[model samples]
Target: MSETAPTPAPAPKRRSTFLRDLVIIVVAALLASFLVKAYLVRSFWIPSGSMENTLMINDRVLVNELVPKVAPLRRGDVIVFRDPGGWLGPGMGDDLVKRVIGLPGDTVACCDARGRLSVNGHAVDEPYVVLSRGSDRVVRDDFSVTVPAGALWVMGDNRYDSADSRVHGTVPEADVVGRAFVITWPAGRWSVLSRYGDEWDGVPAP
Candidate 1:
């Protein structure tokens, strides 16, 4: 074969062409985020002090919108769920986040002689709860609830200040929209949310 000429290098892209490519890249990124928000995870605005000491009002968190499909719900997982029945105002549709205290068929009660919560007659130690003034081991209030089938009993970390499942009763497990996996706002407070792994993980499923 005859010697072939060296192939010429491709021409440089025009400035306008470079800009168009950048626009496409930005649009693709935006679309990816939009899809995540709609189908996988979404950011939520904390609207109240219900979960204080662990999550503050106005702090932001990312919720796995498809949690029900990914894994089974467990005790101590922080979950966000829609207003179950009268939990919200008439016609209002909103979600609330709280730690799961009881699973379906579990009996959750407050304050044993040592001031700890009991599940199925076994006392559970909660190191994250707010304490009574000057008493480090005290958990406030006295209430007992047996979670119904297909429901969950939830409570905020700020025991004395929250109006959670303790107030309106157990919420339908079907109403759980997602599990909050992280705090995304207030960079100083940014961190992954963790459940009571070694502490309560061994509790039998109801």
Candidate 2:
């Protein structure tokens, strides 16, 4: 009667090997991250002040690689592209980052009466452009051009210092690597890269 409780089934053996499980999980996570970086997103660091307040030197950013392929490029998008040709001088990198100012077929001009850049007769309010020492105009020089098919006009937020479309010429869309959507470094400076949507509201289709 005190027949003994069938030796409590040896406490069910733990099926999970702790160390092995952990290692497997870690490996999987790293592989997934690698895949994403390779095809979907990638990281880049700013090397100059061309993007200033929006993207400071050494600031890290996450770029969406599908842009212009899966996702359409917009006028205010911050993009990274390879030097089309002669865009970089000796000692400089082959890549550059700039904001999209004109799309293919767009008529882009500088300095309306208010010194704001114009696209298709609409004056763009660029709150992002930084004035250089003693400079009041966002764009100091006057120029006008129509973006060619399969090309994009780009410029830096630090207009005075950047040698962008104004200096080198329109970048072929094929050369664009990606669009920068966020700033990810210098924890204290973390922020989403803004497109300043309203600024392009008045711009007409190219």
Best by lDDT: 2
Candidate 2 residues 87-184, lDDT tens each?
A: 87897887889999999999999877778889998888898899867766788889999999999999999998888898888999999999999888
Q: Which residue ranges in model 1 land beyond 4 Å of their true spot?
A: 1-28, 89-93, 134-139
Q: Please give the distance, in angstroms, between residue 54's alpha carbon in candidate 1 and its true position after superposition.
A: 0.4
Q: What is the lDDT of every predicted structure here?
A: 0.84, 0.89
Off by over 4 Å in 2: 1-24, 132-135
lDDT of 1 by residue, 131-170 (tens): 7687644356677888889888898888877788777888
In candidate 2, the residue pairs with backbone N, CA or C atoms under 3 Å apart (3 or more residues apart, or in different chains) clash, namely none
Please report the TM-score between candidate 2 and the true structure: 0.87
In candidate 2, position 145 carries an lDDT of: 99
